[model samples]
Target: MASPTAAPALRAEHLTKHFGRTHAVEDLTLEVAAGEVFGFLGPNGAGKSTTIRVLLGLLRPTAGTAWVFDAPAADVERAHRYLAHVPADVALWPSFTGQECLDLLAGVGPGTDLVYRAELVERFGLDPGKRARAYSTGNRQKVALVAAFATRAPLLVLDEPTSGLDPLMEREFRRCIAEATGRGQTVFLSSHQLAEVEAVCTRVGILRAGRLVEVAGLAELRRLRRSEVAVELARPQPALDALAGLPGVADVRWTSPLELTLALTGPPGPVLRALGDADVVRLDVREPSLEEIFLDYYGQAAA
Candidate 1:
């Protein structure tokens, strides 16, 4: 097991991939430190898969390069010793049983460790004798997940790894990830589940239109965006509409005779004072959701 330390497990420098005239990933640069789970998030057609393929050496980059544990992705034998990848649709031989698939994956390397094999079967609730064809998509994914996690590999790249999993299985996946990080393993998780990313990743990069739109810690990203503050006033004063034009207030809406919703972008102090002067029954302040944040970014990108 690698010591939990501050070294980059993966690094991409000015990586660009093009499919004809279309740019799939443009000048993308990022790093995943050892023992950290760096979440890659984007909407459909955002080049998440393209970037993963480049990292896994499944595709060659048009420009720049990607490194797995300081070695080029093109070196399969070297990468096999240090990194593992789990795809969205995990494929296994239908004729074989779950245990057979596990054995084959373990045979990939002489240094492979199966110490966690029995524990993972029980943990993920997988039956070893079940035929691969009989297993659900989630079960097949579990087989891949268990195989990747049971190894001593320093890096694990998972693209939509939990797509077919149910809630219970998702929880188990998260638990397994948490345990892996504790053992100093690095995980590069590409997922649409922002809540999951928010829960597990220490840092994240947002992709839009094949470009890196933003990269920041979760807390920092939240601070840069405005939250919606809804207030139910005890009295009505249409004059409060004046606050709409103030700085840091993006928009405002009147829900009823006394309820109003305001988009606040700055410190809440000034907004709170304005509400106090207007009189209110109760107030609610909520940070914008990940979806909302992305939508706002999209709007800006379009404009």
Candidate 2:
């Protein structure tokens, strides 16, 4: 359990970063509480990576400040003691075997749990005997993930951590994230995979072209959007005509003699009331996918 007054695991105050004349990240202010898994979302050129670099103290923010565990991020020695990180890609020493690389990473970071490292090695299906030169992209990624997960560090910063992983390995990664949160570790994830983020994140922060445009919980974002619905009836009931005029219903279309699809926003009460007396053989409602919710925000920003 996190104390209500606990210092944030990560914080940035009106943070901005620029390269020459181009502003990569601008006026970003955010806070992530202890033990929370936050998803950082953006497309290419959206400044997601730049923001991460500032948070890691790899790049000095052109303006504002970022802190980790209440230590200024620029002071790497003090701030880094509490975190472990795995970037989108990792290149290991050609001569070292996976085990050796893990050992080296562990040594350089805070103390790691050797026992848990062994377990993670097994869970991720990584073979430690292979030298880095023989490893594929996915294998190299595994080495980094295993090291980060096994560390007892309180914060894990992962950027596209599942890049080269197969679907099966992606499942395993999600499991690892669950365990991390269970142990009260905060996770800052930057990824392009909507499904993965939707699976493990408690909240999502969306960045659009170097700016923070929207930040909200998944359910809250969903509430602001519409749902796709398909309905099947025993017959072509006349109630369908009435539903077209009902509040929060639009795009009513007949796909077949017995089936119809429509977009519904807000409460389903009006639609349900209209269908109350009809022979509804089947009705299915699907909340918008994460990609759809994301676009809704982007669309708002663009307009």
Candidate 3:
């Protein structure tokens, strides 16, 4: 049973996983709410996968504790009825067709209803007749996505689910997740593709060198980074390159006809005041994206 005190759908308490002297994941603690899309982000070997494995009960933590829906993750078999996983590389029986695989997994999941299976076939643009061996990496991913979405489980744990998908398919995958989330489903997403996480996740946890560096809402993370400003002036303006040195401004560039762009590390007021004499036509302020925010964190880590 789920906890009543806003306890999160998933959680890790000082979680740690070490392989002999190698610390694969260390002192990590985080949470994901019900019906929320949570992005677990990290560079390769940053312990993202290892942490996920521990959460899924695939590996026991060397130290600490983890829970899903108020139940211990080490008790996955007991909770398996409500969860589904889509790995980075989805493998299936080569001789089986896409439809066959979906049917098989749908059948294997705790329910007998095939209500969502039909929707998955259409939403993913899968050709039911195509054999698993003949599919491209993107197509294989599609098959796994179809199966996962079709399962309509309460929780989805996907690790780079769109690894080989093209932009179009990735867009479709995003739509699939959006639809699933709308129905109050919980998603635990791990990915190197920061853009996807930016587009969909409500909150993100960044892991670096086996430790949880930061975790916050996607919007909050961007706020901690910078704001992008584009100013349209009525007339030709003098070079404002020096604006880059302002307290909040990080970089400035002239982007278009009568437009000056400023990447502001803080509020836009200081940068706006710098253009006081210019006849400003319009000002557009855009927030930094998840990619930009994560990269900034990564840079800080490297430094």
Candidate 4:
């Protein structure tokens, strides 16, 4: 495990990156703590990949600054020593075998556990003897994952790391993330998959277009979004106006004379009690998914 440091794993202060008239990443400020999995959530073309490239020193920030373990992001030689990265689309030397590629990476990177790398290779179901030229997209991704997971670097930056993997492979990816954290490594994950982000990330920062619109813990985010509740009654509900007036009920829809569905935010207790004596034949409550939550909050921000 890499030694713990007081500095955050990553920091961006009013960072901006632009291409001609287009702004790829604009005025972004964020921080990721050491030893925590922080999800960078955004859709494709939302500047996630651009932001990552700047952080990796592959592209210079047009303004502001970025840091890795207190080392300047533009100082790749120095900053990279403290972190390992896996890109969304991985490319390898076609002539080299998967094992050879892993070996070359370990040779150039900070350090690696050959034993752990061997295990990861098996777990990810990679054929190490196969030449990279013959490997499929998923196999190439697996090689990158294996290399990053086995590294002793303090921080790992993963961009859409599970893009081409199977469901079972995705599960293994989650397990690898858990093990990385257990070893005290910080992870900065860039992805748009809400379920994937929710599975391992404690906190997420949502980016829309080129701007960051929201940042919050998973629990906090869920609490701030609306939930859907559907209730069917034996008879038409009386005092419909009164139920709509209840606190936390944002929207009330009468699907039929006897059915009431509501968009609710905050505590459900108030909404539940308001349904008393309606002879509810069916009741269902559904929490807002992260995608729905994103639209509810940042859809306007995009405009």
Candidate 5:
């Protein structure tokens, strides 16, 4: 369990980064609490990678500060002692075998549980005897993931770690993250996979055009989503002018003389009452998925 008095695992205060005339990340401020799994989300070109580079001390911030385990990010050597990082792209010396790569990373990282590392290698279905040059993209990713998960560092920073993984491997990745958090390790997960984030993160932050647009728990975000509703009338339906005017109803359309489809965004009371007046034969309400909600945010940002 994380100590209540322990400082946050990661913190950014008014952080910004720029390249020539372009602002990559602008005035971003957020904190990842000890033992928290935070999802950092953004569309491509939204500064997610830039913000991470600053946090890793690979790039000096144009303004403000980033800290890891209470040490300034600029002090990479010290700050890195408390964390393990897995980048979107994994590169390895072509001559080294998978086992050799794991050994090398463990030797340089904070610390490693060799026993657990062995288990991860098996679970990820990696052939440790293969040389790096022969490994496929997914297999190379597995090597990096295994190395990071085997570490005893208090924080894990993953940037699109599952990009090369197949569905089964992605599930294994989520399981590993769960186990890490269970051991009181903090996780900063930057991913474009909304379903993955929805499955694992305790909270999520959405970024757009170098700015932090919103930060909220999954449940809170779900509340803002619209539900898809399809209703079938048993008989010729009454005109739906009143239903169209209902507070939360939108995109009302009659697909056929007996069927109506609409989107519901808020309280269902009024809409339900209006539906009750019709000769309702069947009704289906499907909740919006995380991907839909994410796209909604992106669309709104674009507009």
Candidate 6:
């Protein structure tokens, strides 16, 4: 297990990367502790990939710096020694069998555990005898995932790692990630699958147009999201005009004589107290999903 005082597995301080005219990432600052599973979320062209490249030492920041295991990200050779990366697009030598590909990656990457590698192969259901040319897009992704998971690197940087996987495979991927974190391995996952991130990540960072917009635990993010509240009153429907004016209420609508639906964006205390005064028959509060929260952030930014 990693020591509690050990240096962060990954850290970025005011990191920025710019093209001739495009700013791919800007002043992004965050840290992933030694054993955390951190999710990096952004829509396409939101700088998720750019940030990952910077962290992997594949691209140097135009400003500021990133570090991996205390080594500067620009020092690829040293920082890479402690990390493994799996890109969204997986490409392999067509002539090499899956087993051969794993062998090659293990030899070049931080060493691998044969037993764990074999287990991953079975878990992901990759056929070792099949050459890369015969594999499907999902199979190619599986090869990279298995290889990364099997390695002994202390940090795993996965970019859209489940892009081509089906539901079952995605579940398997989450399971693997959970196991990795359990073993004290830090994971920096860049993905569009909000549910997947919510299921596996300890914390998540949202990026918008190359800037870090929000970073928080899943529960906290949910709290910031709008909740869908529906209430059905029994007989005396308490005056709802006042309910509509309650704190945190929005889009108040009367769907039926006794039913009310509203968007709640803040604490439920005020809304609950109002409902309590009525002969409430049923009250259903649906927490916002990660995707909803993500869209809300973007919607607010756009507004």
Q: What C-alpha lDDT do the candidate models reach, one value each?
A: 0.84, 0.90, 0.82, 0.90, 0.90, 0.90
**Candidate 2 local distance difference test against the native:** 0.90
Q: Where does candidate 3 stray beyond 4 Å?
A: 1-7, 228-265, 269-286
Any runs in candidate 4 off by more than 4 Å, and if so which? Answer: 297-303
The whole-model C-alpha lDDT of candidate 3 against the native structure comes to: 0.82
Instruction: Tell me the RMSD of model 6 versus the true structure.
Output: 1.9
Candidate 6 lDDT by residue in tens digits, 1-303: 233248999999999999989999999999888888999999999999999998778987899899898789999988888888999899999999999999999988877889989999998988999999999999999999999998888999999999999999999999999888888889999999898998999899999999999999999998887899998888757587688788889999988888889999879999888777788889999998899899988998999
TM-score against truth, every candidate:
0.89, 0.90, 0.83, 0.93, 0.90, 0.94
Which has the better TM-score: candidate 3, or candidate 4?
Answer: 4
Tens-place lDDT per residue, model 1, 47-71, is 9999999877789999988877767
Over 1-303, each residue of candidate 4 has an lDDT whose tens digit, in order, gives: 464468889999999999999999999999998989999999899999999999788899999899888799999998999988999999999999999999999988889999999999989989999999999999999999999999999999999999989999999999999999999999999998889999999899988878988889988998898888998888776776477888888688887888878888898888777777668899999987777887765667656
Clashing pairs in 5: none
> Distance from true position, residue 6, model 3, in Å?
6.5
Candidate 3 or 5, higher lDDT?
5
lDDT of 2 by residue, 166-207 (tens): 999999999999999999999999988899999999999999
Cα lDDT over the full model 6: 0.90
What are the C-alpha RMSDs, in order, of all predicted structures?
Answer: 2.5, 2.6, 3.8, 1.8, 2.3, 1.9
RMSD of 5: 2.3
